[model samples]
Target: MASVGITPLSAIDWGAPWLEPWRVLGEPLAQRVTATAEPVHAVLQSAVGARLPVGFAPQSELPAGTAYEQHIWDTGRVPTRDNLHDFFNGLVWSQFPQTKRRLNQLQAQALATQGVRAARGPLRDALTVFDENGALLSAPAPLWHALRARDWQRLFVTLRPLWAQAHLILFGHALLEKLVYPRKPMVAHVLQAQNAINKIATWEGWLCAAMEADAWADKPFAPLPVLGVPGWWPANADPGFYADAQVFRPLRATQADARR
Candidate 1:
């Protein structure tokens, strides 16, 4: 796959605070897209296609019963990069298109077997949420298991170093909406890491780092909203937020290294 230049997102003001997730893509691509005055579909297609030759087509063109991700690739009908929601979706496609495709496949499978009901299985519900607005999280397997079990201590404190290995790829519109309100029990894809030392400068770079770690390749990642992470959101401004050792355990004074 070719490499698209992904820049840092430090200087750009994405207008709304919730749109902050775009920073994960770094600056290059984000800044370029925001600065460009052309149609976003063209810009996103050019950027995504520059790296992966496959382009998106209209959803109407796709065959009936096509998997979600395949439809996205086959019909590029994702949110355009022009607005906030679509922009993030477009960025996700550029960074983690394969994983996105896999998510679509799983969502389709779940729908096929279970169909739509008022109450869906945990896995199916999780798949739907992620399909719409979930983040792809790649980390160590232990970390993934810890997240799956909601073992906050292990995930945020004991296994802190593993966090550097943890990568988040935001794709969910609902996830972003939830972020605006900010809530608990945020679920994400628990991807196992393939590399720990790779640097995250751009969305593509972050994707490369996670792909290099590909430890959880082809496996269905479980879900958890990582936004509830202790230091991840500003809502944790309350000292009491971290005081809940059960969910947000406190790190040792010496163990606490400032890095958010």
Candidate 2:
């Protein structure tokens, strides 16, 4: 099989619902390809303002042997690449500075104690999962229950009206990058927000406080087919949409047993 290659800068639709939280910082930068790190860093600096916890530096700034997270923790700089993945990562850093820093701090701590072992212990593994593909969901209790239970029908159909009051924010940069070319099966590992957080600042703070090194070992994220969220994708409007068992999978017996 051949690779599709990276999506061009101009091809990204900034107005995408998943991209809404990042539009302010991402839209202007996506206007053209800044193939080098300096221009990308400059735009990020302008967009994020002085409060940005870390500066965006070229990937080369990272020494040959230093781990990525440790470098950021030591120097307060993120090694950025010239691609959509790192671009969205920068947007995330700008939008969720506190949470990003907390994640990095945890990662650095894990690296310090665990070193660069082949098997990143449970805590580090779970952190990587969330960092690469997590989302924050501020929906009603029923939605949360149905989602956690993997009850597709109840989540998207029975209690569908409740979605009007819900908010789903895509936090993971890789998740955001994948949506640049939307696909039905693209899932997000979601963490439900305990309170109704509307402002990005409040959300960031809440997320930072909520993240615990111990709790992360259990991997509390729930899998959600992002596009299936009502109003997120046009095709999902059809009642038959959730019938795709491959995407809206049923909870396995082992998983059900574990919940008991």
Candidate 3:
């Protein structure tokens, strides 16, 4: 189910090492011994993943990568393992701060451009997702860097454009905290709706719905090459505990009724 088709997404085509990181970001594992996937295995290395107790290796394996990637992979891959709650907590601690730091860096570079200078493509894209009323629905990864530095020039440039295309959403209050936080310059933090496949999207929705999840969602959002290897989601594959169709469908209908 992992290796299905080739997607047109740049995340898939980006070529090695750098791309491997994003691929790692996008995959989900139920057990360490995945369904025989090389691309997936490539992303999960001994260096990065948590291993099964000698007895459990036959049942499952931990997805691996850099220290943090290892942690993220472990939580999802080893479902039967103990302490899901703590594992989930540790994963959050690892990801959000790094995301924020990167956003801050990009923001600084964008702002440094000043009145006469031009912002980079990635920098410009980050601010382009804001709302007409000055709210963020979702933003690109680089936004942290852009926000931390207050890239005024890029900010102004992205302002009007984001305002025009402002139908935004965010979801998963718990998981979303890492991607954004209080006092953060987030433009779109939450949204209430259903993507085509029916998922309670906050960040994952933004990724799969807006960012071509069919191709890019299972992979990391970085621009690196190789991406450690490649991994993907099957069209019929379930998202996770966060997205259960039966549960959300009823909830969505309730929201609709209330709106009416």
Candidate 4:
């Protein structure tokens, strides 16, 4: 669903910090990802009902006769910040030392998709509908409530530790959960534009590393095979795993086909 090339480069795990310039170019791109709502909305909507087949939630435990409902729920469980943190912390955090750099790269890439929204309601509505459709995937009650209320500062303080440890665990291979996030800028912007730019770039570095493993994927990409050995990960999809979105978005005439 991500349509090749249209997927941001940072979405892929290319071993290390290879795209430094792209990360540099990524600053405004990330700002634009936040500036508008439509693109994000489209992504959220299209993704609904598609999350499970891709192995999002643990196999939905519907009655044996209701495999269809099970199919729907599994596919529909869109990744959230809580679920995401669980995935990373469960597997990679303490072990992956380079996770910080990886997450910074992801944030930069997500922000720098340099894409934007042209309208409103669609974004918020899609998310609401998705929540309504799926059985609520359990989340940390405190964090979920804060996010639901749109409490930005509290959400930031609460999620910061999640992201911090997550960066250490998950390599920047997936966009685990971004349900609740910081609203205002994390730091004061200095009067100097260059200083402001530097601050944002720094933030991007941390962001990309934590939230971007296949953050580019339309659904949760291919389900990762379970790794039995502690902190062990099976081989990943090669470089260019979800890069299609970049090329795909540009070639499309409109947003009609862009939904998940």
Candidate 5:
């Protein structure tokens, strides 16, 4: 039996808030591994039942009623590079398996009920896009305020310094299945630090578009289409679309320059 030899959370500097959830989940397992003779992977595997999907198996389809996190692990599809990202995702599964499961259930339900319509409605579109390559952004209050106000400058530049405080949680197990190729620093949703802000800002636009039809004024954290960002998807990535300097402002000085 192989074990990852779970390390102490204090000793590991994740450098990102998104990684915190994984650290918390893995901490106890690491302690158990240290205290007992069982392997680390074995210990984690023990917690997962046989009904889940494999993270490594690309052909692995979600069985009806299968738990989402379990399916991800069963498929061995976690886009972990044996690095911080990898470990963080593992920890996320350990801690929020139920939430993860719920998300998957929503996606599955949408697919079964809606099929692949050209326009899969607003909420359904959001759910499909997010489950495939969606990211959860736990941004600061100011950032959300800026987004809600449509103050692109404040959200993209003025308060960019606080971007470090933002946390990104990826929920794209199907997207991770394609990681067998050379993994780019930037994936479908986001691959870089700048992409985080850009993607979130763009997702805001989708929310706005959806609101035109749906009464989603209550669900702020609902999933969004990552590719909805201007200059992201091919059809919407035209220079003219990103030319709205107000929305996609150019980065000239440092984010901290405004404060100075």
Candidate 6:
């Protein structure tokens, strides 16, 4: 029962492997949408209960001249819009409250010290990039080296068997939205997880504690064409799938030179 401008829950391919982790929370909320944020808020509240860090408010509730992150920090109310983007955002907040709160805290601190300028400082910029399109990759060392080097063939084929020891979790709301209609070129700014993790809650706790402004300012992310991850997309099973140079680009000569 989606309202105008909202994608129906039934329309989304919940069976998609990428969406499987979030289907539990997303499916029920999608069925409850009806032109307002209240239903979304209610579901979030019931799911997170007192543990919910912020309350969901209509987008119009946000005051003019207020920053989005600051508003969330000051009032603990997230101005939610009735769209797929915000829908996924709310789902992330519910799923990763600790990590979400840490990100907001960093954003608020930056706004307080730096004020809103034409350009967001490096830390804020990095935070936003990760917030909008970040992912976590827990894989073996060799796979990590190959990915960081942008060695697509080695990562996807040569060391393909190592994928059994890997798990990739999408953390960004926008990333989730884009995956609803997956495209081969869709990429994620990936941060490596230090240890093997089996549970989402464990990842959340680790990510929250790992948030560091100085470290993030350097933009330490590896670009990963998500679908290229083994078994995620059937088309990628073909040996020639990585042949698309445009998507599975090798490391730039300049970067390679620097590495040497």
State each candidate's clash count: 21, 0, 44, 47, 18, 0
- Candidate 4 Cα misplacement greater than 4 A, ranges: 1-11, 14-138, 162-260
Q: What's the CA error at residue 207 for candidate 4, in Å?
A: 27
Error of 6 at 207 (Å): 0.7
Residue pairs that clash (backbone atoms under 3 angstroms), model 6: none
lDDT of each: 0.52, 0.85, 0.28, 0.28, 0.44, 0.86
The TM-score of candidate 1 is 0.52
The TM-scores, one per candidate, come to 0.52, 0.94, 0.19, 0.18, 0.39, 0.93
Worst 10 residues of 5 by lDDT: 177-186
Report how far residue 41 has shifted in candidate 6, in Å.
3.5
Off-target runs (Cα >4 Å) in candidate 3 are 1-66, 70-75, 78-167, 171-181, 184-260
Q: How would the candidate models be sorted by TM-score, starting from the highest?
A: 2, 6, 1, 5, 3, 4
Query: How much does each candidate deviate from the true structure in C-alpha RMSD?
Result: 9.9, 2.8, 19.4, 21.4, 12.6, 2.0
- Residues 1-260, candidate 4: write the lDDT tens digits: 13342433224232222122223333333333335422422332343323312223332333354322223333433232212233332122222223332432433343345322343133322222222211111234454444344343343343534322221111222222221121111111011011122232343344334333343232211111111111222221222322333221222334324532
Q: Kindly report which residue stretches of model 2 are placed more than 4 angstroms away from their true locations once superposed.
A: 1-5, 32-38
Off by over 4 Å in 6: 1-6, 34-39, 258-260
How far is 8's C-alpha from truth in model 3 (Å)? 43
lDDT of 5 by residue, 175-240 (tens): 433332222123344212223453434544433243321332122342223332322245433334
Best-fitting candidate, scored by lDDT: 6
- The candidate, 4 or 5, that scores higher on lDDT is 5
Candidate 1, residues 23-88: lDDT per residue as tens digits? Answer: 545345656655654444566676666664345443344556654444554454652434444445
